[model samples]
Target: MKHLTETDLRAWLAVIADPLATPATLLAWLEGPLKKFFPYQAVILGYGELTVGQVKTTHVLASGHDQVFLDYLPTAYETADRSSIKWWRTSRQPFFIDPENPPAYASAFEIDEIQRFGLGNVVAHGVLNIKANAGCYFSFSGVEGPLSDWHLEALKLMTPLLNDLLLAHFYLKSERSPLELDALTAQQRSIVRHLAAGMDDKTIGRTLNIAEKTVRNQLGKIYAQLGVHKRSKLIALLK
Candidate 1:
């Protein structure tokens, strides 16, 4: 199949816009959309939960041919990029895997695992942090190279919808009912919201029309209020 045009992508997304669309339908639509946008032998969507020092995989969706790849996932995969996509749930920035430009923190063996899992030529993108400490991952793969801009944009266009779906997924599966935070002030809530949406301090400040230093000060207060020491922790809290 040919790659999707912007118009075609928009239409495809619109067809699945029903808020109550079943999970099976969502997965079915996504499989066709992903294959149309990028070349890959198979695709899978994995889900998990994160504790302070542990990550637990709860669910996984794979096209029929790709089930064997899950054998490579283990607790050691919790480092960052390999963590069954749970890292993206708490990250404010988009995590990308280009294979050609793997991040510096990635090790030789980690890279090997990616290749072995049939993910070496894949470019994965994270959507947003949602209920029950979950996020959605959009991954595109090819036979021998990284994704092109067209491919990225096609997936990017689905991010907003993807974020909503993740929240719904968590809300359906979670049992303990997420803890509601009472420490945030109104301004702090606004700040946290912007930060959670992947805005930097400067961007948050500009959007809120405050000084960047003021944004930092607010973030410091927020961190203290939420009992977090860093942005990552703060993100996890917000989720």
Candidate 2:
């Protein structure tokens, strides 16, 4: 990798510092300008509500790859991506995988499936906002060689702004009132509020003077009413 020039550094800073930049715009910068320095065949930015132990909703914010590859991500790819799951649960650091060093967290079957895509090398970062129960994954793939120190440094510089943009998108979505909330009863609404506040079911139950099972049952109904399947989605919907 080439050393980053002062002009290049300033340009990067300018793009990320733009408060009004959208996810698409930031990704465009990555795919275009940034690529000149650290070339990659494809980049994928996945964002949406995520729950511990599972991925609830996955939106491909950006992709410079084949549609078939993009389509597979939400279902087959995600189901088999143990490294991402582990990263979400245990670590915030960026991780890399390549033909030489496949992800240990993945099963042999999973590795085989991924290898079929021919994405040579990959570096992924998990962006999380615990308060909103939302997170994202930014992945750069299809490079020829191992990522250099400068490449890692560039990624570190971009992380905060990417995270802020994702969280902003979440907040914007949350500002709109979903009509589904009207279907919830008073007690159910209370549970939804507690969920948004990042309280666990047990804590909510204690606060509401209800049994834990009752809280769970109420949450189930709330989920049905809101057409959501996980606590994270529920929080996203009502938060």
Model 1: per-residue Cα lDDT at residue 97: 59
What C-alpha lDDT does candidate 2 achieve relative to the native structure?
Answer: 0.69
* Clash tally, candidates in order: 0, 0
- For 74-172, candidate 2 gives per-residue lDDT tens digits of 532343356545653476667667656766664565456458787767776767777986677777788647566556666767777667776566566
Judged by whole-model lDDT over C-alpha atoms, candidate 1 comes out at 0.60
Which residue pairs in candidate 2 have backbone atoms (N, alpha carbon, C) closer than 3 angstroms, thus clashing?
Answer: none
| TM-score of model 2 (CA atoms) | 0.58
- The whole-model lDDT of each prediction reads 0.60, 0.69
TM-score of each: 0.50, 0.58
Candidate 1, position 141, lDDT: 48
- Per-residue alpha-carbon lDDT of model 1 for 1-239, expressed as tens digits? 23567687676566555443454356565556545534565555555555664556555555634546656545234545455344444453344455667765445665676677656555466553445654455554443354446555555655666656654655564422224345567777889889989999999999999999999999998777666799997776555
- Candidate 1 — which residues are off by over 4 angstroms? 1-22, 75-77, 80-95, 100-105, 127-132, 143-146, 163-239
